[model samples]
Target: MGRYKSFLRQRYRAILGYTGLICLISGLVIISPLLALLAYPEELPLAWGFLVPGAILGLVGLGLWQLLAPKKATSLTLQEGSVIVVLAWLVAILVGTVPFMTIQGLNFTQAMFESTSGWTTTGLSVVDVTKASRLILLYRSIIELFGGAGLAIITLSAIAGPVGSGLTSAEGRSEQLAPNVRRSAKLVLAIYTGYNIVGTIALKLAGMGWFDAVNHAFAALSTGGFSTHPESIGYWDNAVLEIVTIVLMFAGGLNFVTAYLLLKGNFKSVVRNGEIRFQALMVPLCSLVILFGVAIGLYPQLGKAIRVSIFETVTCFSTTGFATVGYTEWSSIGWLMLILMMLVGGGAGSTSGGIKQLRVYILYRSLRWEIRRMLMPTRSVTEPSIWQGERRHFLQDDQIRQIGIFVFLYLILFCIGSAIVAAHGYSLQESLFEYASTMGTVGVSVGVTSADAAPTLLWTQILGMFLGRLEFFTVFVGLVRLLRDTRPILT
Candidate 1:
C-alpha cells in the first residue's frame, strides 16, 4: 500500500500538470470569442462576461501548471488521460456558463445546459437566438467550434511532450491523420478550419450575411445545429442555403481519416470505406422512405417533400440536427425512422455523435459472419474484414464484442433517459424521440426542451449530452479511476 501510494503520488503531479495545461488552452478558447466584439462593436458592453472568467481561468491554470509541474517527463496512463480529458471538459463547461449567465441572465441550470449542449456539439440550446445579442450568439458558435474539434486535440496540437496516444484515445479519437500525434492534431484542426472557411463562403454566396455565414458555418461543420435564427434553416427557407448546410453537415460527419483520404484525391479508398458505404446506403434509402411514405402525404408538392425528406434525413443520420421543418405533425412512422437514424448516427472519429456507422456496419457484418460460421463444417476457417481508410483490416472477435457492448450500453442509457422524459407526462413516442435526439447528440426537437423546461429534465438531457458526446466508456472509466485515485487520500 505504501509502494502504491508512492507511485500514485509520483504520477499525480504529471497528470495534474497536463490537466492544468489543458485548462490553460481552454482559457484561451474562452477568451477567443471576445474577438467578435470587433465585428459587433455595439455588443462591447458584454465583453466583461467573457473576459472575467477567461482571465481567472488563465491565472488559475498558470498557477496549477507551475505548482504541479512534474520533476521530469512521464508517460500518462489511460486512466490519467481519461481523467484529464473529463476534467478539462468540466472546467470548460463551468467557465462557459458564466457568459450565458452574465449576458443572458440565465440561471445556473440554464447556463450550464447551454454550455454543455454547445461543448458536446449536441446543439440542444435553451437560449433564444432572437433575444440573444450578436456577441452572445457568436460565443455559442465559438464553443461549438472548439468543442467539436475537442479540447484534447487542440492541446495536443499546441504542445509537444509525453501527451500522445493515451490522451487522443481517451478523448474518443483513435485514428490519426499523420504519423505524429501533434501533426495529426494540427491536420485535424486544419482540415476542420478549411471546411469551415469553405462552408462560410458557400453560405455567404447563398445570400446569408457575413455574421450568419460564419456562425452557421462553425455550427454546421461541427455537426452542431445551433442557428443564428430560431427557425434554423427554415428561417431563410432557401434551397441553396439548405443545400450548402447539407454539404457541410455531411462533410463534418465524415471521419477525419476518411476526410484526409478524400482531400488527397484518394477516391478509391473513400469509396471502399465501410462507413462511407453504410452512409451511402442509409441516407438515400431513409430519405426515400420519408419522402414517399410520410413527406408526400404531409406536403402535396413533390419538391417540398423531396427537400424536407433529404435534408432532415441527412441531418438525423449525420446527427447534425439542422431541421428544415418541425416534426409536430409528422406521423409516428416518420418519427420512428428519424429516431432510428439518430440512434445510428455518423462515422466514428468524426465531429458527429451516436452509435457510429462503423460499429453498426461491423455488427451487420458480424451477423453475416456468424451465419457463415454456423453453416460451415467444424474444420473450416474464414476471415472477415472491412475496409477502413486505405487498408482492409481484419476484424477481431474482441473488437466485435466491444462494439456490441457499447451498443448495448448505449441502448440501455437511451431507454433510461427516455423513461425519465416520459415520466414527465410526454407520450412514449415523444419521449423516445426527444431522448433519442438527446442521447444521440442530435439537436432536432419535438418541443420537449426549452428555456423554461424543468430543471430535472434539463439536467437529464445535460447528462445524456455529455455521455453521448464522450460516448460511455471513457467517462465511466475516468470516474471510476478518479474514485480509486482519491480514496487513499480521503481515507
Candidate 2:
C-alpha cells in the first residue's frame, strides 16, 4: 500500500500538483471582475476587503506552484486522469467562494454553496441580489463562465498531454473538442468569451445598465441563472433584453465543438450532431407548450405571455433557473413539463447541466432497441434509428447498466438531501424543490435553502453543492479517497 501511494504520487505529479495552481488561477479570476467595480463611488468595504485577501491567497498559490510543482512535465494515467479532474474542480470551487465570503458577506457555508452552484452552472444562491455589491454581482457571473466552459477542460486543454495519450469520456464529460485538449480549450474559451461580450453589449444597447447587463451576459453565456435582482430576468422588464437573453442562453447551451465547426463553415457538424438537433427541435417545442399555457390561461396580454413563455422555456431547456415570473404559479401540466425539462438539460460540451440531451437520446434509442429485440429477436439483426450519423448509436448493454446505476445514484442522493431538509423543519414540497434545485443545479426553490436556516444543517447544503458541481461522480470519489487516505493500510 505504501509502495502504491508512492507510485501514485510520482506517476502523475504534474496533473496532481496543478490542482493547487489552478485554484490560484481561479482565485485570481474571481478577483479580476472586481477591479473595475472598486473604482465606483460606493464605499464597497466588503468588496475591497474580499479582493485584497483573496488576491494574496492567489499570489501565495502561484508562488508555491512555481516552487513545488514539477520541473519536468508528465501526462496523467486514466486513474490519475480521473483523480486530477476531480481534484481540480474541487479546488476551483474552493477559490471561487472567496468573493461570496469577503465581498458578499456570506459566511463560508453560503459562499461555498453559491460558488459551487455557479461553477456547476447550477443556479442556486443564498445572497439577496437587491442588496449585493456590483462587484460581487459580477463575481457570480464569472463563476458561471468558469463552470460553463468546464474549468477542468480548460486546464486540460491549456497543457500538452503526453505522447499517444488522449482525453476521452464515454459518458460524463466526454471526448476532446479538438485534436489536442489545450488547443480545444483555447478555441472554446475564445468562443465563450466572444458570446459573453456580445450578449452583454446587446443587453446594454437594449437599455440595461452596465452592471446588470454584463452580469446577465455572464449568466446567459454560462447558462447560469444568477442575476443582479432577485426577480432575475424579470427585473429588467424589457422585451429586447429578454430577446437577447433567450438568444444568448440558447447559444450557451449548444456544444462548443459544433459552435467552432459552424464558425469554420463546417455546417455539417450541426447537421451531424444528434444532441444539437434535439436541442434545436426541443427549444421551440417546449416554447410552444409554455406559450399555450401562458397565452390561454396565465396571462391576458399576448406579447407579455409570449415573452414570459419564451424566457421560461429557454431557462428550463438551458438548465438555467432564472424566472421571468414564478413558474410554480403556472398550471400543473406546465410546472411538470418545466420540471422534466430541467432534469433533461441542454447540450453536451455546453455549460448546462442535468441528465443532458445526449444521454436522453441514447436512452431512448436503447429503449426502442429493447422493444424491437423482444418482438423480433430471431429475424431483425439491428434496430431502426433516427438520430444523425455516428451519434445515432444506441447504448450498449454495459453502457445501459452504467446509465441505470448513475440514475439510481442521482435519485437516491436527491431523496436523501430532501429528507435532510425536511428533518430541518422545512415542508415537504420545499424540501423536494430544494433537493431538485441542488441536484439539477437550477437554483430555483420555494425559498427554503438559505443562510438564516440552521447551521447544523450546513452539511446538507454542502452535500448538495459538492454533488451539484461535480455532478455526483467526483464528489463521491473524492469522499471515498478521503476515507481511504485516513484509514491505515491493511498490509
What are the per-model numbers of colliding residue pairs? 0, 3
Candidate 2 segments whose C-alpha is farther than 4 A from its true place: 1-5, 38-48, 160-172, 377-379, 383-394, 423-428, 456-458, 481-491
Instruction: Give all TM-scores, in the order shown.
Output: 0.97, 0.88
Deviating ranges (above 4 Å) for candidate 1: 69-73, 489-491
Candidate 2: Cα lDDT at 42: 68
Model 2 lowest lDDT segment of ten:
162-171
Q: Among these predicted structures, which one has the highest TM-score?
A: 1
lDDT score at residue 41, model 1, on the 0-100 scale:
85
lDDT for every model? 0.89, 0.70
lDDT of 1 by residue, 86-128 (tens): 8889999999899999999999999999999999998898998
RMSD of each: 1.4, 3.2
Clashing pairs in 2: 122-441, 157-181, 157-182
The residue-by-residue lDDT of candidate 2 on 144-180, one tens digit each, is 8777777566555555443213222311455446666
